[model samples]
Target: MLKDPPITVNVFDEARVNHEMTVELAFVNPVSEILRDCSLTPSGTGLLQWEELTKLPDLMPNNRVCVKLIIVPHKSGERTLLVGFDRASFKDIKTSCIVNVKP
Candidate 1:
């Protein structure tokens, strides 16, 4: 069970441009609602040849899990990767991460 609410997303503070990077996502469902089809998907843009998206198991109330995502920034500077949930119902959740990418 998670001691927080909503969800939490995390990624390395910095990354090298044009290099593959991994972002870790921590999912928390502490409320009384059940989250279905928890997965990560690309934004369809910023196609930096990122690795394939990942899928996660459904989260019952008071459940938590951690997952990772692979990304490759095309350009340097602060890069933001926008992702979505596979279920579509929890699209409004915190589904994005930013990395200070250096060239």
Candidate 2:
């Protein structure tokens, strides 16, 4: 699992309000497992949520998938977002990201 970088958003200022941020993730499945489903879990209150994304391609052996995550932050604080996937032949895989929110 690999992520681009940490995101910073300003949500308090009325003039320059930032309500959302986008995150890019690149992952590779080394085992022979079929990815069935994928979802994102944001930590803390309703400060952040993942926007609906397109379906992920079936991850075969030694295949990589790049996904874009649109996250909406409703408050001002730092939060962590977790990305999880269900595999047909193996345990699920999970990854996380840290975001900085300025008020």
Q: Pick the candidate with the highest lDDT.
A: 1
Could you tell me which residue pairs clash in candidate 2? none
Off by over 4 Å in 2: 1-17, 33-44, 50-54
**What are the per-residue Cα lDDT tens digits for candidate 2 across 20-96?**
56666566666565655743223434444443434566667667776665555676666655555544443445556
> Can you write out model 1's per-residue Cα lDDT over 1-103, one digit (the tens) per residue?
2233344666654577767777766766655877776675545234256535667787898788787766677777776666554555544443565667778
lDDT of model 1 at position 38: 68
CA lDDT of every candidate: 0.62, 0.49
> Candidate 1: where are CA atoms >4 Å away?
1-5, 42-53, 86-91
User: Weakest 10 consecutive residues, lDDT, candidate 1?
Assistant: 42-51
Per-candidate TM-score against the hidden true structure: 0.66, 0.59
